[model samples]
Target: MSAKRGIELEPDLLDQRIKTLAELGDLTGDLVATASRLAERLPRLGTAPPAVHLALRLREAAGSSGLAGEVEATEREVREYKQMLSEAKRKYEEHESQAREDLRAAEESAATAGPDATGRPGSPRRSS
Candidate 1:
């Protein structure tokens, strides 16, 4: 018979499904935080030397002079952070997919476990 027809469920198995979902949520949150960190590390163009030199040369040819600032190491930091963030995101997605699958399996197991032994909704409880 189907679970909706009053078959018993394994409460621990259902709890495991909920735990998997919670883990997926945590992974998603981490991915978002990594993205934000990558964004913050991104280098700005106008403040770097190479870009400033190019702009200065262009302005000089056009008979205009402007001050250019020194380069910051933020570009390197940004590159490193971007790569780390990309890898982290990939791992998070993979784990999330696996966790979702595990949750589904747990739900299916709960649905087909057996008739409720407690006259309630769950399987027979075992001593801890």
Candidate 2:
């Protein structure tokens, strides 16, 4: 396939990937928020059973901080990937536009050149 056609067909994959990445980022953000809320409310449950407090302590020890860090890193990666996708799409469109213009100009040149300009073996050259 031609470069222009290839470019036209290529964006679907990137678009789908970008969409999936965005969804993942959103889900990760929600998870982080939910975890933070759970940690906050766990201690404020007001005179819970001793076993419950022990469970809360165990849960805290498992480290929401690490999960937060991972969420942050993943969010940053998602932003970077989105930016890269946007730049790639912009560049592809620029290339496609230039290719189209080049094709149009070539067609015009060929048409204006008339019969003899094709440079065939038996074609006659135009008078200077």
Candidate 3:
């Protein structure tokens, strides 16, 4: 492919990857916000004794034991989101590397096909 075409394609691929990373990052942020809200609310749930009592009773009826289990579950979800974020970052880096390679190859090919085939300044070719 021509250097211009390669440059165009690389940007398109990079753009797609950036969009995907942004989406994943947004999802991770939302999950973090949710976990934070839950943590904050978990403490406030203790301030109201009557509500706490009712919540405990409801937890017993629902077979959850207490709010701690829910908190743990949310914590696990947060961990999973972090893992996903790491994976997304790795994939982004890989995409960037591949795009760079593609662009470099295209540039090398273009340069080779141009007039300066030897790519060295002082070399002179023999007559045919």
Candidate 4:
């Protein structure tokens, strides 16, 4: 393909990389939020001396068996999000690397194909 076409492909590849990076960033944010909320709630669940005696009553009122299950679920979600973010980031990096390599190759090809000495292809004639 022509250098121009290769350059065009670079932009499209970069766009895809950007999108994947953005998704990874969003997932990371969600994971952080989930971890923070779970951490905050889990600690409060144990540190609330006043709520100790009322735990059973609150559980009945909330209709949930226990906070452990909920905390575990949140932890699992965070873990999954983290894994997804890692994969997205890895893909983005791979695309970025490929784009860079493609761009460099295209540039080299363009330079080599440009005006040579004597304005001829592969000519060894030196310029004035």
RMSD of each: 16.7, 4.8, 9.4, 10.3
Q: Which pairs clash in the backbone of model 4?
A: none
lDDT of each: 0.52, 0.72, 0.60, 0.57
Candidate 1 accuracy as lDDT: 0.52
- lDDT per residue, candidate 4, 20-127, as tens digits? 666765665566455444434422245466666465455443332344345445556655765675576677678989999999997787677764522556666556
Clashes of each: 0, 0, 0, 0
The TM-score leader among the candidates is 2
- lDDT at position 79, candidate 4: 56
TM-scores, in order shown? 0.35, 0.63, 0.43, 0.42
Off by over 4 Å in 3: 1-65, 115-128
lDDT of 1 by residue, 1-128 (tens): 58668554444565555556556545555554544444344244486789777655554433312111111123334445555655555666687789999999877776676444324656576577
The 10-residue segment of model 3 with minimum total lDDT is 59-68
Please say which candidate is ahead in TM-score: 2 or 3: 2
Give the Cα RMSD of candidate 2.
4.8
lDDT of 3 by residue, 35-115 (tens): 544444433356488978866565453333334445546556665665675566677678989999999997888677764
Q: Clashing residue pairs, candidate 1?
A: none
User: For model 2, how many clashes?
Assistant: 0
Best by lDDT: 2
